[model samples]
Target: MHIAAANREDDLQRLHEQITQTRLAILVTHNEQGLQATHLPVLLDPQQGAKGTLLGHLARANKQWQALAEGAEAMLVFAGADAYVSPGFYPSKLEEPRTVPTWNYVAVHAYGRAEVFHDAERLLDIVSRLSDRHEAGRATPWSVGDAPADYIASMLRAIVGFSLPIERLQGSRKLSQNRSAVDVEGVRAGLANSPDPLDNQLAALMRQP
Candidate 1:
């Protein structure tokens, strides 16, 4: 993305946090036919490679997976809290009336060559890790072992696993940093009292220095 220097995020820890907190990612790839995208929950292995690696799966019937050639380039987009910033939220809007509405959001873009695997054992491991991560907060956590072996094997057979060793990572956090202090505060105050949960979340993020 075209992230201004003021809004660019280069901290590795912060980028990893954003990716993990926003578990779902939009995986984009292109081929002879055209471009394709899939929304999937990705697990990041921070120690896997020079930057990191992303793991996820798709249904065996998903044409997107079949469309990917060996060592194909892919991009994963992870989005965090975002909200509309109204021109009225700027304190100078009433006096100058030059401001226009814009969107405030946090996002990370990861580029890598995707490697697809269909081995049952690898698929089981991926499924197990994903289950543990998502179910840890539940009152009764479920595990791959909780199901019958045959059933688990059958389910694994219906999906394919893929890993992308990240070659490049870029992040952007546009949180009204370019605005004047008064305008930033105005945005925070306006979003803080809004009824939308996402707006309130964005307000909290904007408060972070």
Candidate 2:
């Protein structure tokens, strides 16, 4: 990712927070046929490696999993809110009309070698933890035990799990940080007033200190 100095976000805590906030990631891998991508709901184990480890699963019927050898290269792309920016929102546009429209977004890229596993026990633990995490705060939370034991076991057999110990992490948050304070305020105001939900989301991120 080509991140401008003003947009670069390398802070460890912030990066992990971004990953946790966006549980679903696009897992990218390559094989003989070509590149393949899967949308995976992953759990991040922050203490497991130099950076951290990502845990996720794919359906057994998915050919993408069949390409995963012992240690295959992979990347997890986590995307946050994004919105379109118009030069009309910038105060500087009056003085310097050369400004053009742009898009603002937040994203994290994780690169590492992936390890695949099919052990029923490990798969069970992974599914159970993911369930508990997402089900929290619901009026009635569901757990893996809610299903019949044999049913759960049978379901687990239809998927494959993988672990990726992150070797590197890159984060970028382009929220008009490069713009002048006055212009940024104008942009935020314009976005906040827009009816689009994504625009409102970007405006909210810009409010962060």
Provide the overall lDDT of each model, using Cα atoms, as 2-decimal numbers: 0.91, 0.91
Q: Which residue runs does candidate 1 get wrong by more than 4 Å?
A: none
Q: Give the TM-score of each candidate.
A: 0.96, 0.96
Q: How close is candidate 2 to the true structure, as a TM-score?
A: 0.96
Q: Name the weakest run of 10 consecutive residues (lDDT summed) in model 1.
A: 63-72
> Cα RMSDs of all predictions?
1.2, 1.2
Least lDDT summed over 10 consecutive residues: which range in candidate 2?
A: 63-72
lDDT of 1 by residue, 70-130 (tens): 5568899999999999998998888999788999999999998888999999899999999
lDDT (10s digit) by residue, model 2, range 30-105: 9886899999899999999979999989999888876665356888899999999999999989899899999999
